[model samples]
Target: MLTSAWLDGLSLGDPIAADPLEGGYASRTFRVRTALGGSVVVKTQDNLPENLYALEADGLDALRAPGGFAVPEVLRVTPSYIVLSDLGTSEPSPTYREDAGRALALQHQQTADKFGYHVDNYLGTLPQRNPWTGDGHTFFAEHRLLRYLEEPNCHNQLPADDRRRLERIAGNLVNLVPVQPPSLLHGDLWHGNLLPAPNGGPAMIDPAVHYGWPEADLATLLIYGRLSDTFFDAYEEVHPPSPGWRARLPLLHLRELLCITAHWPDRAETVQEIHTILEQFD
Candidate 1:
């Protein structure tokens, strides 16, 4: 429970109210209102990796760095908690989706020399390793795809034959995926992370940011069936996708499916989805 005293300790001021927010599977989130009439979103986790919030703050900074998307302002951060200026969410309009698409494409235009981040970051509670590498294929295969196989949950969920198939697919990334510069990705740009800002533009939250193949972000949005053609059309107006990009959705989506399996070993459906992708590429 949050109290005014706690807010005082953080020097945020006396909170007149704290309202719980939904869709927080990994942490407790609240929209806190202070006596000063300022509202901020507070996210807290009792047990987390030592630097999770700090890393998250870094990611938010990276996203904001590109000046492409509207991300929350990181007002304060501690090991267990983070306070961000509330961007405020609403039901998204078609115009908002289009704006989001354009913003994302423009964001990806800011590329890096290599395919990775300066340091590793998290995808949800899971660690995402990002060792800087020149070859995109090697980076995606080793870091994004195969590395999760070492997770204990994956070992339990995937059979030996399925594991071998995944290896073959990873080995063939060079032949499958088109070469693209290391574009900055929101890294986790699904519908849930995209919000309609009060000013009627797209605001993003909960990023797993890195420099990677831009298709990975598009695939994440398409796989969830939340984004519409308006978004893609607007995106293409800014930055056109590579040829055969649509055909690569299943392949790019393997990263998210594998992560899901690692997070929830009991989710047989996610495992089956992995098998489907492997059968297509392996």
Candidate 2:
């Protein structure tokens, strides 16, 4: 429950109203109206990990550093809640997708010598381990794919044979994925994370930022089947994808499917999806 005292503590003006928002898996989100005659978005949760909100604020800053797309301005961030400047959104349009694609390509141009971030961050509520690794495939295998196997939901839900199959795929990742530079990845790129900016362009929110293979971000966007071909076309204009990337798409998305399965052990469809992908490689 949001109270006027909490808003007063932040000195963000008096709280007029706080309307509940949908689609927040990690926190309770609200579009808060203030007596200052402006509104902001507030995301709050109790007993969060020590640095969750702080790390998220850092990610938004890092994303903005590339000057590629628009990210919300972090007004105030505490362990329990964060206040951000409201960027009203609209429905997705072909032009918005095209703009977003080009923007994302430009963002990916900011590369690093190693594949990982300086510090680890969260993907949803799960800790995403990102130790600096020289090899891309090794980083993706160890940090992105295999790391989730330790979770109770992931370990218990998968049978012995299925686990072995996943391990086999991880071992063969070097052969399956292409050699690519360590590009800045949105880490959790999907349609839901991208809001339709009021400026008739794309605005990114809720990012899990890192430096890794750009194809991973592309794979995430493709898996949702929401964005159209126009986005890819625009992206290619700025930065073309590596050869054989299409064939590796399913394999690249394995990390996300694994993460979802961990968060929702009861979602049988996610388990089936994992099997479906594993079957493709066998």
Candidate 3:
């Protein structure tokens, strides 16, 4: 049995079972049940310079405040563990997918003034290396995506043509648009990180929380195959993607794909997918 020193305040009751939940790449997650009918999701990780659980707790609290989106209620957060409300066992509903766009608009409406967060955070256990200089293009392209591609893991995966194409795209992205005022973003809003609440609303978790362009969230959602078309429809109804947003998708996704490739070099399928997507832009 795994011990959580942070659970001292709450009555955990008799242990039922600790079943593994899928989709977290960095932290260990389990569905913990108690004999007294209480259940919660627990996430554990090694202590790092960034107290991610605490940051997540703060982010969730911000998102649950007045006029914020429906986010999970945080139960406890410590250096090694975080306990959170169990939204449920069910997968995200079509309603979630259908309404995701609108929901995101609502979430984005909850914004902050700064373009960057005060404290730096990680992306899946890896140092995200966001620029403190506050230059969005330089941060997104030069420091994040291009720097990751220079890694041997990414270099070996791309053919010469694809590398050239990626380089050109990266250069082009620098001048695409002036950075918009930063909004509070879920940071890593991929489909798997979102779950359905029992009451038919959407709940978010495992966020790489930050303040950045709203389009960054939309771009990440399009990379995975989970979001439904209804999501886009609903989103546009509330907050439409900016002009040339479609063209910028690959540029935004390049950072995420490179991050994954750097961390999970063995995932040849992911590398192949990156190649395929890059080919489309070329």
The candidate scoring highest on lDDT is 1
Report the lDDT tens digits of candidate 1 across residue range 1-282.
Answer: 675543656566688888999874567999998877778898988888878889989999998854377899888888888888898766666588788989999999989999999999898789999999999999999999999999989999998999999999899999999999899999988888988777778888998989999999999999988788999999999999988998998899999998888887697889999998899888
- The local distance difference test score of each candidate is 0.87, 0.87, 0.72
> What order do you get sorting by lDDT, best first?
1, 2, 3
Model 3 clash number: 1
lDDT of 2 by residue, 56-79 (tens): 999998999544888999988888
Q: Give me the overall lDDT of model 2.
A: 0.87
Question: 1 or 2: which has the higher lDDT?
Answer: 1
Tell me each candidate's TM-score: 0.95, 0.95, 0.84
Q: Taking the tens digit of each residue's C-alpha lDDT, what string does model 3 give over 103-172?
A: 7787777666555666667787766554454556655666556777677777777678877777776777
Backbone Cα, N, C clashes tallied per candidate: 0, 0, 1
Stretches of candidate 2 off by over 4 Å are 9-12, 90-94
Q: Which 10-residue window in model 2 sums to the lowest lDDT?
A: 1-10
